[model samples]
Target chain A: MRVTVVGLGPGAGRDLTGRAREALEQAELIIGYTAYIELIREEFSHKEMRSTGMRKEVDRCRAAVEEAVAGKDVAMVCSGDSGIYGMAALVYEVAQEYPPIEIEVVPGITAACGGAAVLGAPLTHDFAVVSLSDLLTPWEKIERRLICAAQADFVLCLYNPASHSRPDHLRRACDILLAAGKAPDTVCGFVQNIGREGECAVLTTLAALRDTKVDMFTTVFIGSGQTRVLNGKMVTPRGYLQREN
Target chain B: MRVTVVGLGPGAGRDLTGRAREALEQAELIIGYTAYIELIREEFSHKEMRSTGMRKEVDRCRAAVEEAVAGKDVAMVCSGDSGIYGMAALVYEVAQEYPPIEIEVVPGITAACGGAAVLGAPLTHDFAVVSLSDLLTPWEKIERRLICAAQADFVLCLYNPASHSRPDHLRRACDILLAAGKAPDTVCGFVQNIGREGECAVLTTLAALRDTKVDMFTTVFIGSGQTRVLNGKMVTPRGYLQREN
Candidate 1:
């Protein structure tokens, strides 16, 4: 018996990797956050499911290990790439507490990458990725990190930017970036529900982003000095050699 | 008769997305660089292929458009995400030069995302992405961006850091980063042949990366100040909110 930890990607169905599909198909018991379970509900209607809401990740991971130890193939699903702020670490954490279980991690399309792809190519070079949530870390630390990333002229990809109760964080982040010398016209992109039914992309300037409506599901990309808006697509060239014969 | 530009991912078949797979199957004429064509030779054996060596991307893109205009479903395959320093932009460039042709881009796993996933996680926050290649852009500008991103503490992902002809660029970039006050112990990761046969991930520090062997196939990630090495994996935490009990 083994446990395959799979990433379901940013949204439902469309972003499931081939390996994730295979793992899900082979799983006798599937465990994940409720939202993730609902996202892939169609594929596992017949399989035994153990779904929990957020903050119950630790318990869910333990259950998957328990099921695997009981001789059942189990898969714990996470949104986006499993290793990036997903269930892979949590699973490993719990597995260390319990018995050792054979674990396989299947990566998926992360929101940052998916958002960058939709925006043309804003992630062409050295960049920084940060989340605005202050659950484990203090907001002051997150702000300091954001300031550092912005001053570096890095194309920044921000995850978990805002939620219902914390809507002001994104706005504050935008303010800090502006203060850090990021130009108002800096190309900024916001993608919502990527690879899902309402998947949409908007290419705007940093100034415009502050006033834009963004929800928890949105992943934002703030382009650097090198980033440009060409034909409505935001692009940052990686300087690959072009032949000039 | 439309052209569907597809990203074949970092190396070969394993990295191709489901949509990319479908696009290849429907393509009557597949056009790409020889390496990309060889990567998926088995999948497109029956299709007419126009393979070119490096630096011939513009030519290949032009040929693909012409073939598509002649009522053929043509696919222009690019390694990594189609929009990120891939052939999608070139296809659009050539298509503009010719008649207006319908084009759809099918994205695949970019090397940055794939490499980051393999290293556990180093892209969970606001970061900057820059390239070291100065073929299309000047090295002075690349250096400036690197210095800026480093000062900002943005996690940096470098594409095309080194090749057979130009190997010192990555070392120089590291020097610029260090001069900007980035610590020597800053977690840096290198992934070669991601999602392909010779896949290898090395977790090291910035100072060590300067001496490491890197090539065109490698995707390098220099972690932000917050990034750390845990259990042999490079991880960047995306702050998550915890509900009050």
Candidate 2:
């Protein structure tokens, strides 16, 4: 049995890598979250797909492993790179029980890269990615990371910044950055819907981002202290070129 | 006239995104480093190709912009994501002198994403990427990032780990991690020539990584305290589902 964990990239089929497309073509069973499964179904309509609702990641992963262990080629799909906040880890943990299966995690264009492209070169320097979901990790830990990254002057990519259950997470994260001494005028931006339809990018400042309306599908980028808006594009220069002579 | 900054992905043609391929196909002239120009020559042979040696980034980007402003469709190619340590920023900086040209930055598979796939889900949690090459960036800043990331427990993806001129950079980086209280047995790994020929991945510990031989094309991954070696795979669990019952 062989199970392939495929990252579908942001949301566009054009962003899908050849390896991911090949994995889907080779699979006898496809499993994923409802939205992700739906997104890929148009192109992979002939495949057998099983999708579940949110928060059922454990159950979904177990099912994929069960199908793979039963001598079927399985492809588990996730948005962005499977290794980053995707389903790769849960799939591996579930597959441990049903051993003797070959598993390969195919990388994809994560939200940070996809979003950065839409907003310009906001990630051209050393950066950190933190999830503000606060469901699995303690809020205190997330706050600490935000403050540390801010103080270190690292560009930050914040994932899961806002959802229906937690609308004020972005504001709190911005507060932490502000308290860490980041300038209110520091360049910042957000890409909502990423590569999917209705995609839009906003180039703003850290102070403005505090009250920016965002949701689960939004990917927020907080620039480093040296970030700038040149020709209306936000860019964080690579340290070498930005350093004084 | 349009100038598309294309990211050729790590190395393999299949890793290239559709949008990047489209930009190349639409381009009448392509500009890039000698090695990268050679890599894409077979597919884009008909286009007028201009290649240059290393350490001439400013010169190369200026030529591409000049061609674009002269009413030619141009593509400036770089390995990995064009925005991440690639040519997007350079292209933007140069194109600034000649405004009114459409420039699009097409993202690609960066080393962190491409190499992480081969080494399992080592980047499942918050992470940081620090380039070990001090040619452009001073060693002090690199050392500071390594220490801060270690103290914050951010899984680190180290780029440009070693070159002929600086073979001991990786070792010194590991020493800093060790001094920052990271366990000597903390999971660590590297991928050489990721997504291309001669690609190899290693699963080891921080102590062992100190002596590992690496080169300019290598990408090193340093696992956090929560990272573990399971079934020969390096994995850092996402905090949400990793809480103890």
Candidate 3:
């Protein structure tokens, strides 16, 4: 038996890819974190559900792998793309203890993509995706990433910028970028609850975003030096109009 | 009328999201580069299609915006996520000359995510995406990005690593990564024509990848300091089993 690891996009419904949808439909059991499971419960109501609470990722992956080992086709779902800050890596780690079972990773639209669309096209060139939550990684590494991305002039897509555990992480990251040479007026944006109810995207400057309050559900974007605000939208051109190719 | 910018997701069929598929079905005219249009030609055979040659991006966006201005519902397609190094920003730029017209950017699976799955989970942690092609951006900028991302220990996903025009670009990039402190034995991989007919993924050392031949369609991934090869699949752990979160 095989366990199909699927990405459920940022939220639900229309963002799900045809292949991911088919994988979910074919699975005999659905498994994910409690909150992510609830997002798809209405659509996959007929399937058996298994979920674990926050910070219980090991349990969730182990349970999913054991289910697959017991001859059940399983779908281990995650919010956004499964491979990026999602459960795919953990699942692989946990699956190492079980008997040989195939694992398939179905890519989905991650917050970087979903959030970028909502705020226009802030990632139209080279970019960096950094998460500011220091729960797993040390704060120093996170600060280093922010500094390097800013120094390289990469458009930045930041995940977990702020959460209950650390409300000032975004603020610190902004300061790091500023010190690393990112301009104060650099275009930035954030999309909260992307592809879900109450979804909203706000465009602002890096200096302004430093003081903005956002929760865990928000995805933040900081533009490169070439980024600009056009028609009330965030856009970073790849210099196509300068047109030399 | 509206011009919907849709990402075709790497290649055809199963990778297309429900909303993107719906947008294409509802559009009166589908526009894209001649190559990307052919990727979906068989599936959307019944629809009217308009495709431009390579380097004619401005022309393609102009036509799409003009078609939407003429009251036709249009879908302008890009090979990967439209907001990332794709046509959405250009569409918005071109639309600036026309009367106010609604534009919707529907996200899709980008190459970084799709190729990461094929290679097993090289991007499990924070990462940087840099395109080696200096077609639009200067080569010096690309070099600086590679250096900075390496110095920061960010997992890297490289796009357009090589092409006929720049056959040695990937080699040059590998040298730059090494000079920036990335170990020569660091795990690296690439996926060619991801999700397409002859798709293939191979894992190698950074030194080995330096010598590998890849075309424009390939997406290359370089692991972070903590990344390793697990069970023949690349995995970068976020320290979940190390259990500190």
Candidate 4:
């Protein structure tokens, strides 16, 4: 039996792709982090579900593989696009250790896109994405990349901004951005659990972002010089022509 | 009646969000360019549809506004995210002139995220997105941004890389990138009609990218040094700890 890994795509049930829906429908067992399973829980009623809490990704993925090896058509769910810091890689790694388990990845809308969409496409131009989590990489490298991206005027999307232990990284990143010539007026937006029931977006300037409440569930966007607040919405133009007469 | 502008979210049918699906299901007149209309044609058998050709965006959007003014629930469809170079801006522009029409925007998954998913999250770190389309903005600005992003080593995603009238832009972009110290072996990816039936992804280097045939339908990602090709798949390391055994 084959296993399917599906990205729930942001938070909305409809954001799931047709392929992902079919995979979930056909799966005898659904396994993932609690939040991912909750996001698409309504889509499947008959499937057996296994969910783990935060920081238990490895465990959850391993369990999914175990279920798959037992001849169950299983699906591992991830929020947004599964490959973008999702379960796709972990599953692949685990599969390598457990032979004979066939798998396929069904793509979904990532948080970066979800946040960018709410902010009026600040990423329409060249940009960089950096997660603030230094669990693996040194904070020095993350800082250096932040400086480089800021100086280049890249539209930056940050994930894993703040957890219980890392409350200062986002603040530190803002400080670095300020030192790199990104103006205090640069548009900064944060979207939390985009497309979910409590999903919300905040639009502010870089100087004011420090006062904003951010958490591990938030995705932040730092806009370029061209970013502006238009009628309460943050927008970065994509340079489309109007055929001026 | 209000006009709910829905985004199809990439090319897949399931990428449509719950809000977008509900809006479409409730709409009496569905209006969009041909490609977007074709995406949800099966869901609109009983609804009235007005599909326009390319370059007729303004006209189609105006018609949608007119329909809304006539007290019809209209769904104006856009591919990818509605706000990013989609019909959202045009709808707003026309709505200002036709005050009777009210509008709401529904977001979607953009091509950047779709390409990033296939390329193993080159966007995971800091990145920049720039459009090579000079139809509205001058090429000088686009060139400067490219140079800046390349020098900063920001993973870069380029939209509107080439079209029938501007085939050399992608090649010129590669030249500018080379001048900025990006290595020739730097992993670069090109995806065309991402998530669509004819989707094609090519993983190559910066130097070889200049020789590739790219069209407007393509989104090209030039990865940072952190990006690498793994078993024929392009992957940008997010520095997430694999497992410390």
Model 2, B1-245: lDDT tens digits are 88788888888488887788888888999999999998789978888999988978888888889998999999999988888888787677777778678888888888999898898889888998888888777788888888888878899999889989999999999999999899999999999989888999999999999988888989999998889887788888885445533
Query: TM-score of B chain for each model?
Result: 0.95, 0.96, 0.98, 0.92
Per-residue lDDT tens digits for candidate 4, residues B1-245, read 77777778778376666667788889999999888888888866788998999888778878998889889999998888776567775666566567566577776767776776665545655566777888777788788888878766777888889999998999999999998899999999989888788888888999999888898889999988888775465666554435435
**TM-score of each predicted structure versus truth:** 0.88, 0.97, 0.98, 0.88
Model 1 C-alpha lDDT per residue in residues B33-89, reported as the tens digit of each score: 888889889866888888999987667878898988888899888887776677765
List model 1 lDDT by residue over A23-127, tens digit each: 888888888998889998986798888899887766787788888877889989888777667776555545555566677777777776677767676765556
- Supply the global lDDT for candidate 1: 0.78
Clashing residue pairs in candidate 3 (N, C-alpha, C atoms within 3 angstroms): none
Backbone clash total for model 4 is 15
In candidate 1, how many clashes are counted?
A: 20
Q: Which candidate is the best by DockQ?
A: 3
- Estimate candidate 2's RMSD in Å: 1.5
Candidate 4 residue lDDT tens string, A99-122: 578777777777877776665555
Q: In model 3, which regions exceed 4 Å deviation?
A: none
* Candidate 4 wrong stretches, greater than 4 Å: A1-3, A65-72, A93-101, A116-127, A241-245, B12-14, B98-101, B117-126, B241-245
Indicate which candidate wins on TM-score: 3
Across the candidates, what are chain A's individual TM-scores? 0.93, 0.97, 0.98, 0.92
Candidate that beats the other on TM-score, 3 or 4, i.e. the better one: 3
